[model samples]
Target: MEATEIIIKCILIVVIFAISLVVAMYSTYAERKIAAFFQDRVGPNRAGPFGMLQPLADGAKMFLKEEIIPANASGLLFIVGPSLAILTACIASAVIPWGQQLTIGSTVIDLQVTDINVGILYIFGVVSLGVYGIMIGGWASNNKYSLLGAIRAASQNISYEISMGLSIIALLLVTGTLSLREIAEQQHGFHWNVFYQPLGFLIFLVCAFAETNRTPFDLPECETELVGGYHTEYSSMKLGFYLFAEYINMFISSAVMATLYFGGYNFPFMDDLGLSQNWITIIGVVVLFAKIFAFIFFFMWIRWTIPRFRYDQLMNMGWKVLIPLAIANIVISGVVNNFLNNA
Candidate 1:
């Protein structure tokens, strides 16, 4: 790559990282506001105009507070646990296409960091590794509650990941490419994959909730029974890392959903705008984020709306319900594609 291109890519990388952190931070504020709104309370209005500065205040508190490593805890692994969680969460956005390429003089800037051909598999692999962070943290804490939470998280992610991958299989059969950018490009101008793979989308959405350990499936960190779940023994920024990672995962999942089911940067009536390439790219980016925010709101809404599932119910839904539906979707997609290709 030319020096200018390298510089540009580096800048983009920093920007992407900052955006992820900012979105994750704000998601916490949004979640609190949403929760308060649901419960008919004023929420954090005193901090800074409807608690706009609450995240920064919370973050500062986390950094300033004392960090504790229990005498019984494995210090190295304990530190590694939260670090790994945040690391995995941050890196998963690399393959996501943020927007169309921008033309600046002779230099063309693609909004994505890297477009690996096996982007989808890369996502699945990285996401699978995220469970290790929770497992390691909980195990290293040397607390029974932590260990139990860790085990629950590991099992939950593994069970749902199967269905999540199977659901994606149907979409892959339809799209014929594992590259996320290619999939997004194919769905340009209102031809979103949701129309073709609605079942796959639903299965994927449910699996996503499980994967992220959101409410209704948040058995791993169930506050009532586990007292704080995997990070119960953690404190200060070490604990902050784990919590921040969850929000980051939510943000990334939102982006992935927007890319997969809705359309990454594609929008209806985009062509009708008749705008310049730069303007079009900006608008597409806005449209994509709008969808992402809507999904994020839905996630928070579900967290407040649904009661946490009983463990048996959570397992049954994963194994007996979602997995089978995902399998059926794959079979149907295959048969339909076969008939279409044959005819």
Candidate 2:
């Protein structure tokens, strides 16, 4: 039994990791195609049919590019920077519950990699460490622009993470559990936490944008100012890691958002369908991916629609607006929960 469980876990891990990479790879293609559509231009039609093979071409380009290490830079840390970035980005998917268990005859298989009791905290910890990758990369580059970008990343993450944590606190008050699995189960039958925690969701959404360094919050990598930001000095596959890390982070962020406020794998009338367990589980996974893809599209849509925020404006919103709102949300959720409990 133990060996079978270990084998199941290993398979789940590999599948999830492969999925993350594939999604991250194609996100680059999607971003380009979406941008082209928005701009009334033909996208990468030359690469393949509808440019489906563009991501593969891009990967080949990255791999074939010349590797350059700055003469003055610390070689080891420079490499470590992007390596760490991609590593942290990939690992955050571990706690996300992709769907309910799959039952085949007497065998039951869990979709998630692991269900730690402190799943939310584990995510926070991983996200918090992600900044170090950017910071280390920037500092190791031995360039003023790179250092500045790194500093921006550190400050931005710190500012937004406070509000992010506060927003999660409000969610915790409502869910009354730290385990993500419990949170998903509680939201069965379209009883999504989003309906109850709209304000918290908004706050979290904004912070997610900031934490992932998406547009309007992409001050650290503002090309006009920092010349490729922290990655200016990186080249070849080293640079590929940083770029891939961003898309992977976005993918994981979208998945987390879906899992959290959007009810993970739960859907309306899921029970009414009267499907078999395996069928429901399969459909639940599909529904969860649908939600995740929608969120990813939203992320890309905002990138093209909104101009980047000035650093001061970004800081002010995080410190002044979102933080206060998150705190208020926590208070409101506490009162509401207390009232419901008493009633």
lDDT of 2 by residue, 1-343 (tens): 8998899999999999999999999999999999999999988888889999999999999999999999999989998999999999999999999999898767799888999999999999999999999999999999999999999999999999999999999999988899999999999989999999999999999999999999989988999999999998999999999999999999999998898899999999999998998888899999999999999999999999999998889889999999999999999999999999999
Query: What's the TM for model 2?
Result: 0.99
Off by over 4 Å in 1: none
What 10-residue stretch in candidate 2 is worst by lDDT? 103-112
State each model's CA lDDT, in order: 0.94, 0.94
Assess every candidate by TM-score: 0.99, 0.99
For model 1, how does the per-residue alpha-carbon lDDT over 142-238 read when each residue is reduced to its tens digit? 9999999999999999999999999999999999999999999999999999999999999999988998889988888998999889999999999
TM-score of 1: 0.99
Q: How many collisions per candidate?
A: 0, 0
Residue 107, candidate 2: alpha-carbon lDDT: 79
